[model samples]
Target: MHTTHHCKARQSQRGISLKMVNYVLTHGALENDKIVLGKKEAMQRLADLEREKRLLMKIADKGGVVVVADGEALITTYNCSHRN
Candidate 1:
């Protein structure tokens, strides 16, 4: 029973991590040195992306223009070319 519970916990943790990864991948953008988000707008955008599985790119375009960060979210500009 204990072993089963432990395995289940691990599975759940993994799922959570994957979801976070997906969220970041679908939202985060790299500019210059740091990976950051648009702060206020990112929360809503993240929700929309998670529900629909489609990113709303009104802020930043994906591919050569913008690159996603690895872990944790931060605040930054929408334009990849722009620097702080």
Candidate 2:
């Protein structure tokens, strides 16, 4: 869950909260070096977590999230234009 200063700045600039970033990191799919959670993937994950109402409510947004990771630390995160 570690993030660089640059990543924190980007999160503030992009209005992407740390909670959302954590959600993407926990649920997103690995594509190359990034973890991506698009609308489609989010929907699928939502369905999978349907029984967990609280968890499901947390990640109900279909907006895409792309997280770049360096080992266990997070390098950066941004909203996905193409995936949404």
| Clash counts for the predictions, in order | 0, 0
Candidate 1: residue 48 Cα off by (Å): 5.9
Best by lDDT: 2
User: Model 1 over residues 1-84: C-alpha lDDT tens digits?
Assistant: 133666468868777454554555566787786445566668778687686654445344543145455567644434464644
RMSD of 1: 15.1
TM-score winner: 2
Q: In model 2, state the lDDT of residue 61.
A: 54
Clashes of 2: 0
TM-score of 2: 0.53
Off by over 4 Å in 1: 1-16, 46-84
Give the poorly placed runs of model 2, Cα more than 4 Å off.
51-84
- TM for every model, in the order presented, reads 0.26, 0.53
What TM-score, to 2 decimals, does candidate 1 have? 0.26
For every candidate in turn, the CA RMSD to the true structure comes to 15.1, 19.5
Which clashing pairs does model 1 show? none
